[model samples]
Target chain A: MELKVYVDRLSQPSRAIVIFCKVNKIDFEEVGIELLKGQHLTPEFKEINPMGKVPAIVVDGKFKLFESHAILIFLASAFPGVADHWYPADLYRRAEIHSILDWHHSNLRHGSSFTYFPFPHELCSDETNVFQLNASSAGFIQNTLLAPLFGRSLNPQAAAEAEKVLSSSLSKIEALWLKESGQFLLGSSQPSIADLCLVCEIMQLEFADETDRNRILGPHKKIQQWIEDTKSATKPHFDEVHQTLFAAKVKLQMQRK
Target chain B: MELKVYVDRLSQPSRAIVIFCKVNKIDFEEVGIELLKGQHLTPEFKEINPMGKVPAIVVDGKFKLFESHAILIFLASAFPGVADHWYPADLYRRAEIHSILDWHHSNLRHGSSFTYFPFPHELCSDETNVFQLNASSAGFIQNTLLAPLFGRSLNPQAAAEAEKVLSSSLSKIEALWLKESGQFLLGSSQPSIADLCLVCEIMQLEFADETDRNRILGPHKKIQQWIEDTKSATKPHFDEVHQTLFAAKVKLQMQRK
Candidate 1:
């Protein structure tokens, strides 16, 4: 049996996997579990993933895997010919990739975590839980992550200096767009898992619509240009099949509304 | 240059890697990073690991790897003699192992996180991040993990009822502990990466003294018994190396007192 990816394009990890499969030409089946319908909470899905989260998969009827980073690494490991750069065999280069993956959960993951979705689970429940669904969580990120780090960022702001770097995380990315020397981050090398990660995270950030283009990704000159440039490179992958899935997802959201 | 393991035996992930190296018989030099001295926070080590965490390795003069589970999988992939069962060659089985590695972070790792030394940096400044190091961050596991599934675990009320199984998460493991059985967790198997993870997580529930013993791990039968048996089974890697580290760690705490 071929590989099967159980995904919802709405999920950042799921999008990463879809893009990876497209770029690498991996043939697999697609199974969508609607998050809004609470399908993930169902017992059947729980058997596949006790955590009841998405971006899970069933491989050859024998193994079930969760955690997007782990899955991405596994795919690259199993497919060697993808290129030496994607996951280099050399120690330091491999270590560099590993380092990025490691930093992700604590850093980039935090950025992704703060974005808000329109769920009422935390608020509707007891006051003690204090967990906000999606949007407020994004606000949580702005304060805990974007705000403080930005305040402490690149420029030595006389005041609010920290905030300048905050936007560039988004904008510096835009600056990279301006300097399209390489198809992916980490230079003209084959896009490593980091590229997949950035695409999802950037998409999620843009989804928030809070990012101001000019100062953030734009100010860097390269990142702003790179941001749009990277998206365009991957445009063909998301075209025929991805558009259908994306439209269907939008319809699903409207139905929820 | 040979591989170098930077470890403190008392740490969970550190012990897992140490045990893997011993069991696999991979040759390596040992270098200690003094956790008590706060060596990890130093500028020099930061270059080695930006995360400033334990159980890191510098492999073959170049690769520096952190995150114990990731290291464990890498070792399995890098070393030829290590049984495939530990990591598994089949895609799905590997995925199952990967799932646990990921889930363990929120489940088993969460359980383990609750059992910290509760150390703080400043009685002088009264900066109470230490006091605020609430085990409560891990309370979700009690409600979600132990109460429903494991039953009687660390529950003060059921402390006596489920004492045996509750103590070690290994009462059933008694059957698996026999010498002649020879196999490890999966079957008459040496052990898979899954076993490595469990060994690491279980070790974290250990405490320093009699008072601590009464607190949780000591009072419970299954838990205590499991700790004893497993530690005995893996004696060489720990009692020799980890015990030394553990003693020094205790001494450091006593000095603080």
Candidate 2:
């Protein structure tokens, strides 16, 4: 069985899937779909995922799937060598993970630095760039990081609102999911897909200005430690998959100077 | 094993879980948490779901779970006599359904009429109502239907923006999931949990003023038919669970006169 993962590492969920595959030793070819270049929107890519989103996969060149949570579940369930802890076979445990994954979308994903970008058309003359960045999957970077990177002022109100939601989300995670003893979410000894997915999401804040990133993430000490724990558990693969985003972050900092 | 489902039929996902249990003949007690009355915010409900959202469940008075999609999956997986089509044991088929369910949160739920409500504080002097409605789960009705019902003008820009996202989401669902031969999503012969979840989400449009509701939902003929098909498949339970929403719709229409 051949598997091909189409991804753009800059996208949070895309990075999560890539890191998961690497850590689990899932044999698959990583096919990059550049969000900035409009690669995901091309007709050829659309055939793989008609939604025109990345972090999609094709198996044996016939079956196709999109949505990172689904792809992670499929990978965990279908792959033979993947540890059960990644997605436990136990019905109750799996359902608990699913609850976090589902909640992540609307709350953490929606409220985090990744809130959908509403580009002001007048500010950006390049229609192609605007359109590509407008795609929901790619909207995050443009909204939180790219705007400032490109010398466009971030909308203060939107930023404030996003920060408020993000802060509240972090607090909830700290109070509800993180336990006093457990290293991972829900007190699990091993990291689940929920950990990988949410950690990747919070990692997107690395692209934000250091002050803003710290301000938003600072209060939640447990979440910060949990993120570190998840990264450590995943080993070199976590940082390996995030190289693109980290590089971009350095570039943004350099450009700011 | 005893199961208790905490829900409010007025919430779309809450109703979906209720309908799923009733249709599958799963023995569960439904505990209503009235969102409007701030019942979900109380200390007791938080014990059931620390996140304080409805559509949570407790199993045998010990284990608790939240998130409607997760709850539905748990119900389908944990309970006997639930048809396979609802959540197939087949890895690929279940993954396909998961893809849609995950997508529903960010794209369909976020973009549809249920986009998070940012109520203008001064517009409503009743602090309690504002606080209760501000809770993410209960925000939808206030934004689309209740605002107008209570004589507040809907923000045109936000409405237009929501419509654009909703339209694009519906189009994607039509082009990608619906097939000419099948009545349910992903061309399944029987309705899956994906069908029930999405159909219930779109059904929230019924609370919108008729012209806006029809105008927004009118273009997607396949989706319209699919919603009907799913309703028929689920039988009396579908409409039975939605009675609260439907009744509220009637009240809204009466007030508009």
Candidate 3:
């Protein structure tokens, strides 16, 4: 079987993978899943990934994997002769790349992920569900995370306090984008996994109708460059369907605007 | 020159590496970065890793890498046959291992780490600092992760919610442990990278105070069994320092009781 990637181009990692395949001429089939429409929730996709998440794939009926970074390495190694900067192979350099990738996976990936498309408020359909869903994560971060950091033992009301603080952390991320002076993050060099993580996240922001590029990532010259790079580099990977989705999203003036 | 590992036995990843090296009989020098005393923050350690994190190593005076999973792989591959469970040769199987490890690194690692230490609150010294240190992570899980699973859009909640569910997620993890049904997590037949991840994270709970245990893992039978297995299998790799760390923690608890 040829490599089959079930993805929605609107998703950043999905877009990056689609583009990486095209740029390197890696043979593959693009299967679009309207993520919001619950396409990935099908029994078929669940068989592929128990998590029922996207950016999943099967390779030559052999190696199958999820998690974007894992996929990135697997594909890069399999494809061969793609841009070396996408993932360099020297042991030391590769380790450096992995370190940066790990940091990006958690920070940039989670940073933009939480800000643009918050999960709890949407997942919980009712007040009880909302309280449980939101309260669970909120409780953990504040009671378990923030309380320890502040040297205060866990408290029942701590999550509310944390919610206040979490609301303001976005600008720190924008500041990071500004601090790095490259056109693409991790330097003026070509976009690495770091760039991919960030682009995907900020794309969520743009989709949300909150296009304050400067407020989020505008201060960072390199992040802005990455947006430009991704836009130009990955056009063909997007089919008419995916393009329509983005157009529909940008049409509305969403919150965080 | 032998490898040099900067570590403090209290940290899970550092202890795991120490165990791995000792069990394999790999030669190495130990440089303790007393985390409580902020030795890791000193200028000398910063030169080794800008993040000033523990569990970094310098090999042959050249390759310097961070990230526990990356380090485990590098060591296993570097010293072939030292251990089979660290990573397997089967690409597909290895991919499964990677999925688990990656998730552990991003989620379980944070949940357990924060519950144990709550670094952001303690270290940041104030509300602004706490937000500056860690709110983004809480928010990301809330908005990006939790919402997606339920077929909803993300809100600024997954981070905290994800953390809260962690206390309960232990049961889910126990189900996984039960599902595996073996001495090691994957099987009694052999260990896998899954074991490495579980062993490290679970070790923290095993050594955690009974009060903390009830607060989190709660001596749940499945969790207890897995902990027992890890201890028996990992004893060969256990350092005297860790033995004392465990003993001291338990002893301190006894005094309080």
Best by lDDT: 2
* CAPRI class assigned to model 2: medium
Name the regions of candidate 2 deviating beyond 4 angstroms: A115-154, B114-153
lDDT of candidate 2 over B1-257, digit per residue (tens): 79999987877788888999889999999898877676777899889988777779999999999988998999999997899999999999999999999888766765553432223432211111222333232343455555664567655554555677688889989988896478888888899899998888788777666677788778889988998898999898898888898887687567657
Q: Pick by TM-score: which candidate is best? A: 2
Q: Please tell me how candidate 1 rates in CAPRI terms.
A: incorrect
Q: After aligning candidate 1 to the native by TM-score, how far in Å is the CA of B207 from where it should be?
A: 3.3
Across residues A1-257, which tens digit of lDDT does each residue of candidate 1 receive?
46888776656677777787777777778788667576766798777765567777777875677778778877777765465666676645565565555444433443344332333442221111111232212343333323333342221221122233244244433343224566566565356776666656545444232343233334454544454555665667744334544565465346434
Candidate 1 chain B, which ten residues in sequence have the lowest lDDT sum? B123-132
Candidate 1 matches the true fold with a TM-score of: 0.68
What's the DockQ for every one of the candidates?
Answer: 0.22, 0.59, 0.30
Name every residue pair that clashes in candidate 2: none
TM-score of every model? 0.68, 0.89, 0.73
Fnat, model by model in order, equals: 0.29, 0.90, 0.36
The candidate with the higher DockQ, 1 or 2, is 2
TM-score-based ranking: 2, 3, 1
Q: What is the lDDT of residue A253 in candidate 3?
A: 30
Is 1 or 2 the stronger prediction by lDDT? 2
